[model samples]
Target: MDEVPGVPAGLLGGHPRVLAAAAATGRLPGRAALDDYRAAGARAAESGVPLRVLVETALVMAESMDPVPLPALRRAVSALMEGYENAQRLALRQEEVARREFVDDLLQGRADRLAERAEHFGLRLAETYAVAVARPAVPLDDGSVRDGTVRDGGGVVRDGGGVVWDGDGPARRIEEAMVARFGSHNVLVAVRDGGLVCVVPGSLTVATGEFTHHVRQMFAPGWRVGLGRPHRGPGGVVTSYREATGAIELGDRLDLRAPVLKAADLLVFPVLLRDRAAIEDLVTTVLSPLREARGGPEPLLGTLEAVFASQGNQTAAARRLGVSTRAVTYRLERIRRLTGFSPDDPTQRFTLETAVLGARLLEWPAHAPG
Candidate 1:
């Protein structure tokens, strides 16, 4: 084996040695050689060695057996190669399974030897980590994934719960892009609960921007990305993941138009939702009068939302609503007259804006509980 040209010392194994002996004997190796080759292939896959190199080395070993019949040697090498390929496939499947399990544990905050497992995947539990989650604006299909086999729009529905996607979907593409930008060691991308989750060191200020860039490339205007603040330790991964997921869900509920949302920026929303009774009461009391308007609460509600969104500028609100400034003024007056809350007064404006946000959050009038 040492005498074989172009064969690295680390790659020298019983399989090649057995094949050489069989070639010298003008016969192919039996089962033992096949088992050795399979083991070698698994090692090669783990060490990042190319199969082409292995094949070329085998050819060199075959060539060295001068005056020996080539048929037996060729057959021996063929058997060895088959074993190698089979082992490589097995190694790959096992690697994928390990990765999936590690990601699930990390994101779900499962602490069963999680710190030790994190090291296996190149994660440093001492460092702070942030999570970014992304999904298509419109889900691939309306079907629920079952038995870990359903694939929709490149997403797989996990049997346990939520989408667990794989293959050549947006998740794969995003993973590739992120790895290309940040290097594989710096980022971990996985499909969990039906969306793509990217875990990157929180210190990388541009990480989320890079994530957003890649997501936008694949799903412009139709995708949403939620970013969670970085937290330290293994549990931090789970915390950040939850924050990212929460941001995405909140954005959906609030009808937020922004493609990118940060959990830190929307902190007030969770606070508002914490006391549901208080918010519901606020919405019903301050804005209920608009229900009596000619077109019901929607028109008046839109006026308030637009006015507040425009920072009290009637002209900008009008532009947003696609109505004339005079119309906006009239609507504002109608709201004041109907609800006794004026958008022009500073204190009243604050109360009106909070109620309006609560209304959107509660899906008032249209879906609010009767």
Candidate 2:
């Protein structure tokens, strides 16, 4: 009749039996529980060994007697309680460390493993997976931290929902939540310096109108996030990661909301972003009046856009605008006379086309007929 069936410690000593006795019956060993402790001892003598023996040893080892010897029994009990608390805390700290080491080992093995896992994850998801760039909400020495990454080293994205929700310590909770939303089990999160990486599945890769709100909620105090286009497998994952990084970098360079630039912008030059300045003058001076409907020149701004898009090809421009070719020529001549841009010149045409797009962004006045 050992106090606890699963544990056997009686061979070591009687002291351990006290802990085993208390643990077995779910009661602190009073004189009554001591009977169980004794029974555990008896069982140990008969069987190979009983758990109570070692448990008793542990209990005794944990005991610290006060030299003064005032109320020694009470003091001993208090010391035992303290030891239990300490043991619990230490165990928790050790477990946390162990988990971290586990993750590190997984990361060190080779990206190939993660790649393989991510591919399976991607297939399981059967949906387009996107890599989001998470930046710190606040600025850092090298670059800004992406959102939530500081709070939760890795975030799991949910389907149709932004990963803005705080996940408990599981670290994979956010991903699990996404699993619920997207209806897939293939999801993984990898954390790297400066960002959190995620693998998702599905066909359309970009965060849609549905995800925008969640992105802000997922945002943390010190980090920001920019989502990358959805990609497939390793190539897609890498592409999305690069895009997310680019978005963060580009966002950092531009004032918030100057615009959300995409990965394609990486190939563009600084001059091109500012080059829109060249078209500002033409738009403000010539196209402004044309856009005015009440007592303004006939609305030829549409005409202007079509003409520019066509590279000044009057026939093509006419077809595009649903106007006759002759009508297209008249509008082209009208534009040249009003704005000093001769549609025949290829260079002038290029400038006008670029200007139109830039003008829309710069918030310049409409084209006014000269």
Candidate 3:
């Protein structure tokens, strides 16, 4: 066994003694001897020795022992293999539990022993970190749609296409890929609310795109990514996570088509949301008049949205609205007459655009305050 090239060094130091004791049983190893061998197998497994090498060593040793029968040797080896597998399975399970607990504590701002656990998980609390959260653009059927509220403390809410935490498949795949690509340190990927959330060092410029690419490759297109800026310390993880979550919810509300949304780019929306009363007043004052238009406010609101998105190009706005250019022009005229704001003017257009964005974020008209 020591001469075997593939065998892990020091793995066979005590194995010979255990195998000899088992071989003394003649036909089948006694319980005591088999138990000792099983324990030895577990130790080897814990030390990261390959099972194949251990098994091959046992078979080779058994060949040299005259008293032990092949059937008894086989049974003893089977017990050893079972012990090895059980130990490995338990280790893997414990690792997974630790990872999930770390993720929860970090994301939810639970600071109990956070610094200690953070070190164990390869996170340096002193350094800056950013979070990237990704999910299928079209929500998957996670069966939790009817289930109210976030279950895992991952901040997955029922805003728009809530990312329900599915099984471990996607998360596992993403974690493995990330570890392979970025090495096993300072990168953590976990499943929260059915989306893959990755915590990477802020210095990685391509993390956002790389994470999105992996998700798209694994789950296909129709996936969206939200990224949060880098922040320092344990509290930074929480802040970045919430930022990513808000970006996804905001993107969904605005029906954004971008594959990746950054919190930095959407900072203005949160500023607008900070004064809900003020924004509501703005939406109500600037846009509520559109309700008087024929076919209610949706058609006019949609036309305004298209016109702003198309940068005042009437033909492009018409194409987007699937109406004739004349119809778009007529809607703009109607908007001007109704709200005294012109999409044609650069100054007034800004006010109209901001108000329109506020309406979407507030889910106006349908949920508009009376």
Top model number, TM-score:
3
Residue-by-residue lDDT tens digits, candidate 3, 105-153? 8999898998898888788878999999887644443324446543322
Local distance difference test scores for all models = 0.75, 0.48, 0.78
Worst 10 residues of 3 by lDDT: 150-159
- Candidates 2 and 3, the one with greater TM-score: 3
* lDDT of predicted model 1: 0.75
Clashing pairs in 3: 137-222, 163-193, 164-193, 164-194, 165-193, 165-194
lDDT of 1 by residue, 144-260 (tens): 344555454563423234433344566677778888888877888876665667899989869888888888887646778899999998888888988988898888887777878
Error of 1 at 196 (Å): 0.9
Between the candidate structures 1 and 2, which one is better when assessed by TM-score?
1
Q: Which stretches in model 1 have alpha-carbon errors above 4 Å?
A: 1-48, 64-86, 138-165, 367-370
Candidate RMSDs in order: 5.2, 14.0, 6.7
> Model 1 residue 323 lDDT?
94
Best by lDDT: 3
